[model samples]
Target chain A: MRVHELETPAVLIDLDVMERNLARMAEYCRRHGLALRPHTKTHKIPELAHRQMASGASGITVAKLGEAEVMIQAGLTDVLIAYPIVGREKAARLAALAERASLTVALDSEEAVRDISRSAQERGVRLGLLVELDIGFRRCGVQRPDEAVALARLIHDLPNVDFRGVMFYPGHFMAPEPERRQLLEDANTRLRRFYDAFERAGLSIGVVSGGSTPTAFISHEFLGVTEIRPGMYIFNDRTMVGLGVARPEDCALSILVTVVSTSVSGRAIVDGGSKTFSTDRYRAGDGRGFGLVCEDPEAEVEALSEEHGHLDISRSSRRYRVGERLRIIPNHVCTVMNLHDEVYGIRGDQVEAVWRVAARGRVR
Target chain B: MRVHELETPAVLIDLDVMERNLARMAEYCRRHGLALRPHTKTHKIPELAHRQMASGASGITVAKLGEAEVMIQAGLTDVLIAYPIVGREKAARLAALAERASLTVALDSEEAVRDISRSAQERGVRLGLLVELDIGFRRCGVQRPDEAVALARLIHDLPNVDFRGVMFYPGHFMAPEPERRQLLEDANTRLRRFYDAFERAGLSIGVVSGGSTPTAFISHEFLGVTEIRPGMYIFNDRTMVGLGVARPEDCALSILVTVVSTSVSGRAIVDGGSKTFSTDRYRAGDGRGFGLVCEDPEAEVEALSEEHGHLDISRSSRRYRVGERLRIIPNHVCTVMNLHDEVYGIRGDQVEAVWRVAARGRVR
Candidate 1:
């Protein structure tokens, strides 16, 4: 079947573009002597993670135990749960997963470490632990270098736990050109401080995982970083485009939507909305609209209800009639992918595959 | 199983609270002599929709044909797809669905009307259509009253199409009391003009559907509105609380999340984030956070990444530790419900049932 023949509000993945993106990222990481463990939170597909592994990814990184379970069940032997795992049930589940695969977890708090350690010891399984450092992204990880060393020391003492290394997410480094470069420099300085602290503590940091799509290509600049866990690089989005990291042509995924209503003047409504494309705005740009209209670049999706994409066609010279199909590259691809149950993989106009987003909505 | 024993980042629906919400709305519509066609987009479960039907609902309202199909398959005889049905394939699907159930589609454009009319005629199915009017919310409706009459006339002329009066979404009338009163007055004036235009056109307007959660109770204030379609009243969120339409105690759905990280000084991280709770801010409030922390009402979900809910617990006098469970009422319940696959129906602390969000992600 053709891509256009598919249902409206369908997610389409350009196979050629996606393959190129994966190959490019894999090659970049290989050249930099960095292990590529592309985050599976973006696509949430086990097959795509397998493809990433086939493209020379060392392992796969996931944000939740549910996602890791999906990947492990799909024959993946090595996996990393990048988020902190707390609670007795989750820790027990993590230990159970560790029994099946070579599992690693990155966490900040000593409480989480102890929780997981107790579960792993009870299950008689060894799990790799990466002390998460709060280099800049203030969401997770420890603040000071001493805190990181303390966590590492605690992990080293914990039974059934291996102190692998440190991991930090430079999410704040997604600024544009010159500003991004400066942010990278500051991030590297912070990395050096953590490395110096680790060395002074007589700790051998085996793996230093840190990278986002904005800083993926410059992973070498981090000096001591060993692995890159960029998720969005596999399927580029408008945020990556706005950050000058990926071109519009590099965006592999697009929502095929049909114009449902053009009754309101200067605005047309599409079948896709927040429930389809999500409410994630283009933060890397002017922070205005929800997506980039591929049909008419000037047409802006100004607002969205649950199932109505309010397209501002005032700027576009082209006229949109109801039932007309249009493709939109959403601002954030990760959230958009998570919203759907399945996605179509297309080669040009032909639908080659329909892959169920097996790991989507696995927030547990 | 207990609700607490369930996994973190799980969607929990207080069944008692939901039943009370359903009963209240039913009684309100019964007293007001309005047809209560509650929108099922909030819960998206076939059973919940059936429960709404059991609660004296005239019919059920859905935003997409996929949702209509789900409801119809679940033995609903009357379902109103309160959204535009565009494209040949979708129209064919709509026609096919009409063969099994009484389906009414609401659209603003003549192109959509003609498109669906062609399919319905070919399939020997007479489909009902409501000419959507822009009462105040400028999303997907005709601006002028004359345009609505014109669309009605066109629908009347079209083969296999029944003109079922008019419909409008009063989404803009969700302000606080004083401002909301003014907006409602403006909306009523606009609705009156549409009614006058329909009367002058010699149109027997059978149905006048209008209402959102905010404007649902005041639906009788609109002179010609005969049906109310409020979705969020089933699972009230922080938005409804902020709008003073529903209190925090009235919210039926709350996400069960685990506090994962507390390393950051005034902030804590929960397992639920934009992918779980969504990026929709609390528009009815000060619009600072993504959700209301039910544990400490003063604590706010300041920001969200894909898998991390950043909680600002500075104002709360409580200190959060790792493994602590928190329940969050999201800003928008509809979008939050769309992100999850299933919801646990609980009675107090006991899990009574597990419901699959059957109609979720059916944007087509």
Candidate 2:
């Protein structure tokens, strides 16, 4: 099937562009002697994960155990769950999954470590544990280097878990070009202190995994980091473009939508809305609207309801009529991919393959 | 199964609360002598639609044709798609759905009318058409009454399409109590003019359908409105409470999430994030965080990542520990329902039933 032949509100991935993104990131990692473990939370497809692995990814990183289970089922044995796992039910599930695949989990609290230790002991499997240090993103992770060493020491003494190094997400430092480079350098300086604290505590750090799409290319500045995990680099998004990590042309995924209504002047409604493109905003405070229209660069998606994307076409000279199809580059491709069940991989106009979003809705 | 037995990050519908909400709305419509056509976009479950139909709904309203198809498969014969659908693929699918159900579509343009007419003609079925008028909400509707009449006339003269009355969504008039009454009255005055103009054109208005959740109870204030279609009344959210349409106790749906991390001093992280609760902000601008934490009202969900909801518990007296479960009332229940695949209907602490979100991801 061709791109024009498909239905509206469908997710389209330019395979050529995606392959180029994959190769570029892989080569950059190889040049820096950094192990690449691309996060699968962006595409959530087994085919894409396999491609990343074939291109030179040592392992795949998932946000939850549900996503890791899906990847394990697809024969991707090495997996790293980058979120803190709590609750007895989830720990048990993770321990069971670890028996089948080489599993690693990030932890910040001792309670979570004890819970996972018990689950792994019951399942008779050893799980790799990474102490999550707060490099700046205050969402999760240990706040201080002392806390990181404490957690690492606790994990090392645990019966069924191995203390692997530390991991941090510098998501708070998303800026464009030179500013981003400086932000990364500052974050790396703090992270190196945390790594040295672990060494001073007589702990040998094996994997210092830390890197987001905004700072993926400049990850080498973080001297002690051994691996980098960048999720959105596979698809990219308006956020990456705003942060100067990627150009608009480097975005591989887009939503193919049709102009459904054009009754109101200066505005046109597209078939794709919050349910299709998602409500992810550019975190860099760029205020570039919800998504960008690829055909008319001037057209801005001012607002989005559940099923109607309100497009502001006042600045554009071209008039859009009903039934006209438009491709939109979403603000964040990760959330958009999670919203759809399947995505079409297109080469030029022809759809090369249809891949199911394998781990979509795997929030657990 | 019991509520406690269910995993974390689950969508739970309080069956007793849901039944009371359904009854209250049905009784409101009954007292007003208006036909009840409850929009099914809130729950998107076949069982819930059946319950609404049993409560005295004349029909069900869906946002997309894919939803109508799901309703039709569940033996629902009456459905109105309350959006302007374009493209040949959708029109053909809509026509096929019309053959199985009493299908009606909302249209603001002549091109959509012609497209549906051709599809209905090809399928040898007559589809009902409603001219959507922009009374106040300037979304997907004709701005002027003459444009509505023109579209209605076109539908009236079409090959296999019948011109129904008209439909309008007063979404912008969402306010609380006495102020909301004034807003509805003002919107009704403008809508009355459009209805009168359609009558002046010799078009007999059979079904003047309009009413959102915020203005559902006082729908009779709009003199000529014969029916009301409100989706969110079934599962009221923080937005509805801020608009004074429903109180917090009246909300039926709440996400059951477990606290995964509490390393931060004033903050705790839940298992549900944007992927589970969605990124819909409070529409009434109440400044309340993403969703209200039910157990501790003072605790606010300050921010959300893809799989983690950060909660600020400094103001709350209750202390949350890891693995502790909390119920959250989302800002918008419609979008949250779309995010999950299934919802558990519970009575008190017991799970009554598990209903699949039948029309989930039906963006087409």
Candidate 3:
């Protein structure tokens, strides 16, 4: 649908720009000699995964087994689940998925390793599992080097299981820090220590994966990493701009919304609300609220209701009268795209294609 | 699925409890001699709408044309779209829905009225339009009674359109307060003035509708209003408990979540993240966070990541271990249910039935 003629609060993806972004990231990985596994959790659409593969991605990375299942059904064979799997039902699901495709799972704890091993033995399938190590963020993963070594030893000793390499997420390194030599050297030291422990355990690790979007930009010298998974590079959002990674023109996906009314301090209320933008709050240091106004970069959407997005478009000299359509670049692209069923892929204001978010509600 | 066997972070709706809640609202409306037009936007499944009709609801209300289309396709005959129709696509869609169903639409401006009137006239159907007056919340609707009258006059002057009545929403009054009487009275004053203006404009106003969950629990006497549309009472949430409108036990919908990890203090990470419990946040003076910690009313969920829900889960001497499940009353019940493609309706721990959120992704 045309932007001016269609309804407000619809998700829009620029197809030409997105193809360029996919190619740029793929070429970056090729030039740096890093295996590219774009996270399907970001776009969660099979077509986008196919596009990433066509652009030279080695495989797909997912956050959940259900997401991996969708990719497998869509002909994406090599898949990596970046989440630790526990529970009898979940392990069975993982084992079943491993039977169809090359599945590698993450294990962060002793309990997880034992559980996964037991499930793999019961299913009579050799499960490929990675021991997760936390470099920072303090969310998941083993912090101690000895613990990582022990996890790898346990998984290797168990029946019907193969111990893959370690996985560490250095999310804290993505803050656009002033690249001190100490920070770089310290990250290398930790990685070296972990790999040394794995070597001492007499285990041959298959893949040593680490780095996110912001971290992968400087990952060429991260020393001991084999693969990099950067999902949001294909659809840079306001958060990327806030973190100083990408520019506004680099944002590939934007919400096509209309100005429903202009009232209350010239505030134009759009039809998008928390349901569309999500309730994610980001501290960009400037204290701008909700999401970044895309059509007008300086404009701010200070508040959101369930069905109403409020924007402070009062000060712009541009005339945005009622029924005017505007595009919004959300702060967090992954979460916002996850909230929609399908997004229109526009090529210079023409609706070229519609991509169904294949794994939109695969939260299991 | 059985409550104990089903995966954590899944939504569970007890059919028996939901029926009781639905009966309670219907009985209250019957006693008050008021028409109950339950808004189906809460649970977009048409089966629930059919059950509501079987229990004596005058009609069901929808938030968007996409949702209305889904319900109508499921054989629902009458629907009231409680939001304005502003675009060509939406107006045309609304007119198409009018052919087979008795549709009542809310309009607060002449532009929307003329848009709907033009489409409905072309389709040879008279569209029923309600003049939405602002009572509070400052979102949509005409600001004053005279503006509502002017809008009604314009709607009546247009061909193939009927002025249904004045619709005013007191959403800000949904917060619990001792001054609830003043809030309701203030809302009534504006609505009564609008009703008089409609009469002075020689309009045949049919339905005066207004009510949210908080206002539904109290006296819903809006001067000359004939109907009240409250959707969340069927599945109460923590927002209801926080507002002192409903007790925790009344929350029939909950996210059955498993404690995935334990780090320090009484903190535990649940499998439910913003994807499941949603990211809606509202606090009372006591400073309640995302949700009220079940079994420990004093505790709250302090933080949330993409796939992790952080909870300060204990206020007593009992320690919370990993693998334990906690039932989470979400901040907003409506949005939480919408996130899921389907919900399990159970009784105690037994699996009874599954309901498809037929219009979950119908956010046009």
**DockQ winner, 1 or 3:** 1
Q: Candidate 2: which stretches are off by over 4 Å?
A: A176-182, B176-182
Error of 3 at B202 (Å): 4.0
Off by over 4 Å in 1: none
> What pairs collide in candidate 3?
none
lDDT of 3: 0.79
Tens-place lDDT digits, model 3, residues B258-363: 7766643466677878878777875444645777666666567877776778787566565776667788778888888778988888898997878899888677
Ranking by DockQ: 1, 2, 3
In the range A1-364, model 3's lDDT, one tens digit per residue, is 5655556678888887788888888788888888998887888999989989988988889988789989999999999888777677888888888788888887676666677778878877878888887664566777778888887888877888788787877765645457534566777887788888878877788787876787767778887678888888888887777777788788888888876665344577788888898877763546467777766766788888777788876676666666777888887788887789888888886888878998987888
What lDDT tens digits, residue by residue, belong to model 2 across residues A1-364? 8899998889999988899999999999999999999999999999999999999999999999889999999999999999999978889999999879999999889989999999999989999999988776677888888888888888988899999888888877665576766777777787878878987998989998988888888788877889999999998988888777789889999999999899888899998889997887766555659988999988989999889999999999988999999998999999999899999999999999999998999887
Ranking by lDDT: 1, 2, 3
Note the residue pairs that clash in candidate 2: none
How far out, in Å, is residue A22 in model 3? 2.3
Candidate 2, B108: how far from true, in Å? Answer: 1.1
User: At residue B44, what lDDT does model 2 achieve?
Assistant: 88
Candidate 2 docking class: high
Q: Scoring model 2 with DockQ, what do you get?
A: 0.80
Candidate 2 per-residue C-alpha lDDT over B2-80 given as tens digits, one digit per residue, 9 for 90 to 100: 9999998999999888899999999999998999999998888988899999999999999998888889999999998
